[model samples]
Target: MKPVNKNDRLLVHVEDLTHDGAGVAKVEGYPLFIHGALPGEDVHIHVLKTLKSYGFAKLLEIENASPFRVEAPCPVFDTCGGCQIQHLSYEGQMTFKRKLVRDAITRIGKLPDVPVHPVKGMENPWRYRNKSQIPFGMEDGRVVAGFYQPRSHQIADTDICIIQTPEADSIMAGIKHKLTEMGIEPYEEETHRGQLRHVVVRKARATGEIMVVLVTKKKKFPQAAEALKLIQELVPETVSIVQNVNPEKTNVIFGDETITLWGKDVIEDQIGDVRFEISARSFYQINPEQTEVLYGQALEYANLTGNETVIDAYCGIGTISLFLAQRAKFVMGVEIVPPAIEDAKRNAELNGLSNTLFEAGPAEQVIPRWYKEGKKADVLVVDPPRKGCDEQLLQTILKQRPERVVYVSCNPATLARDLRILEDGGYRTQEVQPVDMFPQSTHCEAVAWLQLAE
Candidate 1:
């Protein structure tokens, strides 16, 4: 017999939180997932949909609230898809993130002995994001700009977003209004008509330089001179105004052609002592402060002796490679993106770090090629994406057998799986440190330290 049915209202206690910030409650051993509900809470839910194994419920009332629950600061926090877990306190968020990493490493990696440290959190987590990607659309014949609604393409129009930088908030509001006043049409995905599609704003935390990228449906921007002037007047700090053209009716944000409508083609920013020039499409970290901390942690885990060679796999823009190059004798970086390799080389030159070498190719392919050329790394570092390390890269690491490995990961599940593979291949997992990179959201980043077993 099923414990829940459509339209059935029941009182339940939330025992845990899912990775996506949903509350988990069990009814006769059947699981129910309810959004906006926190752990250690009693709630009334109306069953919406039921599957064979689990069910979905809508939160109707909070009979008893958890102590960790707090009033969300963003007005559109309930409906906007930008952030989850905003209702939970900052401390609670960190604790939940730490638990997330701990559980994955323990259950998935099968490494119960490895210690997972508490999440390294920021002093003030609000408004830390240096970049904002806002999609523009039309609603009721009016220009709308903001994040999309949960699980839908409908935009949640807002004048302010608390998580984004102050400069971006002002830019989004000003640009949307300027577009509306100028009678420029917002992109309509249904009809695939109109001009403006998205607005991307990036602000350098250290330098305060800003870049505004306008993604349009076509190359011909209406009133280009007037629009650029308005944008400059609106955002006085903007150093770059770029236009990216995308004619296809696709969901992708960027197109092949990019034009600099005004100012420089790139903006400069600094992470640690290393300076970098970021283009409109460069892959720079959104949270610069935490990135410094994360990279510093990886550098510490490397335990460089000024004589060892280090290899940075999946190094984008030479962030980790340059950081390690400052201490190690030589650092080599491998990236699949060719432009990222170019940017990395330029960044290395900008910092006058002559010992770093960056090559564009798959890390799995490039590092092995380097080994054949009589080059080997004493310490290997990998900062892979949410998908974690590639299987071929892991096999290469096993074959090369670096003395120490520093794994910087965005997804703990994949991190755990990869770490298990390394552990089985004669590497001993030492410890894992979770970093709260994205606050007020369920996402977490971690750095794991491993050593070849003696």
Candidate 2:
């Protein structure tokens, strides 16, 4: 190791916790985040960069180890950026996730009355990921596939990812080898003329059938057909193959053109005996097992009695809306994306569900329009995107005053902010639960049930 640059050096011990990684000690009464270190560990850190309030660092040594600290299994633990808490014990990870949600509600959202239960961790953390999105990048002048490194734009070449399903890992060697053999050009960010962008894989746990979606920058994905054939030959259990073209320069995913190469354009999966059809662009929880539990919790909080009408706002492909329709008199799902709404209707019809309906529009707009016609939604379930509910949607919900409001959020920071608005609008937080959908990562999903405040 190179000798220390003392000019930037600042030693500190971590005191509390941050959602990102490790918490840090106060140096001269200023908090400095000590990376690669665990809580309750005293460590000497070299401050790399200083911010206005806090600073970042690299751990020089661990003077004391936290009880929760455990050696991460993967070689790419800190580098790949896929999982952050691999160094943390499974039990401790759950504790940290729960506390983070509680703290977010209490401090960030300023909602102290709300109670957040201990975050639920997976039974078998490894092989839990049923879905994988592998980006294509050039390495050593050859096309390669793997996940990107932590907080960086560069993609790292790795074959084995411990978190995904066994089927996902099985096809890795073949996919990489074929992509290299075909000499498919990797997508260059500057030119945006590459034939390969990403290789998305999904597997149904119940059926053991896999679906591979090839994402390219251009429409002519001749390599995808050859690659899919090779993948099928290697693994015949692959039920379907699909392709999508993403030409946008931005990192955000909105597959510009979707084409199914073989089999079905949509993949099928079951959650708690209930089957669901998900297209390539549709949103389904990456972790299927945990999603069942989450839906159970949301349903419990909803207190549905089989006689009420439920409206699932921001319902992507009717996952929850269709699930609730089985019990409720009628379930109506609303989504902004047209493709997702179409998928929801097809899924509902495929499952022989007749009571649920899906529409395309903003929730705020839909909720108000429905209210004008005197539609009494006894229960309203909202599964919003990361940004959380908008102001107009909040106002519409309050005006309608549904018997119960179930708000499921992926971003706790935004969830907390929206909860405050709900509280101000006379809605009381009934319960909040956190689900550790993505282990080792800093992000978490939270559900907040609200009703008219007394």
Candidate 3:
């Protein structure tokens, strides 16, 4: 077989999609990932790089187009790294995400018989994100705020983003303009010597409340009062304006110090009937509409009859715990972040929920201790991070043998792997439901239901 070289122009038939939404084409069984290509399309690609087993290419021309292809509406779609698969139609995205879950369970988990449901998609997928974290940088001696370029830290200057809420876009643009007029320097990552690093915006969909967080390189925000005045006048609905200082050089968005520049420190939002108070660093779900759907599926899987105790692992701000408490005899939540635990307790008190307990500690350590203290769980619910559940936590769950295990996951591969471990530990995989939490992007969320072997 002739080895493909860089800068080689080749015509290939696109066959499948990678996990990140790039199209796959093969030359003699050597897979070449092409950006912006889709399945069932014949495309001309310029080979960018080649490896021993696979290659990377750039889409040059579409000789044939798939019926599922659509015109991407975002002007910066090609450069911004915020989203992928926007060129594919929403219906096609749903089908692809559903297949993603199914393929992972069948191939990774080795559970071909486990039922995976069709993806629950949004009625309108665009402008669904309630949160936006735009990096601030200087381009051509002017302040710019937008997403980074694909796989790179270079900011793609954008005035608008379709996935983010309209209020967030307006507020971000207003602050960027005001700060630029005030001669505020955007953070220089290479030198770490500038003032502003990022601007994060969060909008509550139900309440129309907004929060604007300015991440700075130092504790002192230059022209703080004037900047806050401009932001408030521009976006009057904004209820919170915060400043977070990070003196150290790092890529992380938030720092240890957060101070309210104006208004309240926290903003209120709701998922279904439960209310939550969100702070600067709270791990609230970005998409509120689909969070209701995802959690609703989890609630359905629990099948609580108000007489069983439930344990919520990795419960951030008591969002899932509060939901479970409404229908269970008692609910206990465990989290690793202390601030998030405080927020959880505050939220529980705000909702007047007395049947719940929130503790700050690692679930792997805390849940086992609860079991030792004679606190049993009839249902176990976990909404873990993208890395999925910890091994020790999985072992603890298996040892406790909760009658029902409701696993909420953001990564299908890890979820499948963990499910296989649980299945081997005497649990039966019942069903999986995929939800499009981050629409117009490649990320997919799923809730899995499992039961102890009969």
Candidate 4:
């Protein structure tokens, strides 16, 4: 193989895509990852860095474009790190996501026979995000708020984001402008001195209610009332304005202190018939429309018959627990975050769902205690974080041996790894359904059905 170095330009054929949406090319079996190059396309790439095992390249020219490639509509599509694969057509994105799931299971999980279904995608794959979190920074002596650039702290200043709700975009833009006019200094991460750190906006798609959170460096915000008034006037849909004080010198967005500047601290939203109360630090899904679809798949896979007891692990705000409760005899949920448990209980009460119970603790510890207390789960449902289920939790699931296990996952690689462990413990992998919860991005959500082997 010829030696490859930085600044060496070469022509290669894109053969595959990585988990992060980067295209893969090979020269004499040596892998090279190139951004902006789709599968089955011939492109000229400039080698950015070459490693012993693989190399990184930048797409310079596409000699042959794939039929699935589409022009990204966002003006900052290239610079903004908010999304990847926006240049690919929506249909192509779905196909690639489905392949991602299948490949992960087949390669990582070593489950080649598991039936991975086609991805369930949105009819209109744009403007689906219900939440927006943009960092506040100063550029050219003016306050700017937008997402951070790819792999950097530098903010990509923009007036609008195509994925977020229009109301959220307008609200952030209005707040940034108003606060700048009020001389409210944007937070500087270097010295940790300014007042404003970040702005988070949440919109309820069903009720058209909005919640705006101003994350600041200190509790005292100068000209707070005037800025709140300006935000309210600019976006009439905003029903809640909150200030979250992060006095520490850290990268975390929210601090321990959350004060409501005006109106309620929580906003109401619904998925199907179940209602939820969303707060500033709530772990609500960013896409509600796809959430309904994703949870519906979980419900379908659970195959509740109105007589079984269901246990939902990592159930945030009882979103899926309530969905299961509608058909099951009883649903018990466990989460690590105490505030999420509070919100879950409130949501359960708001929907008049008495068949569900929520507890605040780590699932691995709490579920074992529940097991000793005679609480049994006919069906075990887990929607764990991207890192996947804890090993102790997996061991507990195997020991308890629920008749059915419905796994809802955001990361296919981790999902496959967990599924392999379950399959080894006598669970038969039935089917996997991928959902496009995040459109125009590389992330995909999936629900898998596993049955106890006879």
The lDDT for every candidate, in the order shown, is 0.93, 0.80, 0.92, 0.92
Residue 429 CA error for candidate 1 (Å)?
A: 0.8
Candidate 2, after superposition: displacement of residue 139 in Å? Answer: 2.3
* Per-residue lDDT of candidate 1, residues 212-244 (tens digit): 998999898876787788778887999999999
Supply the global lDDT for candidate 4: 0.92
The sequence of per-residue lDDT tens digits that candidate 3 reaches over residues 45-126 is 9999988889999999999999999999999999999989999999999988998999999999999999999999999998
TM-score of 4: 0.98
Q: What is the lDDT of candidate 3?
A: 0.92
lDDT of 4 by residue, 67-92 (tens): 99999999888888989999899989
C-alpha RMSD by candidate, in order: 1.0, 2.9, 1.1, 1.1
Name the regions of candidate 2 deviating beyond 4 angstroms. Answer: 1-10, 248-254
User: What's the lDDT for residue 46 in model 1?
Assistant: 96
In terms of lDDT, the poorest run of 10 residues in model 2 is: 1-10
Stretches of candidate 4 off by over 4 Å are: 1-3
Q: Count the backbone clashes (under 3 Å) in each candidate.
A: 0, 4, 0, 0
Top model by lDDT, which number? 1
Tell me the TM-score of model 2: 0.94
Residue 330 lDDT, candidate 3, scale 0-100: 97
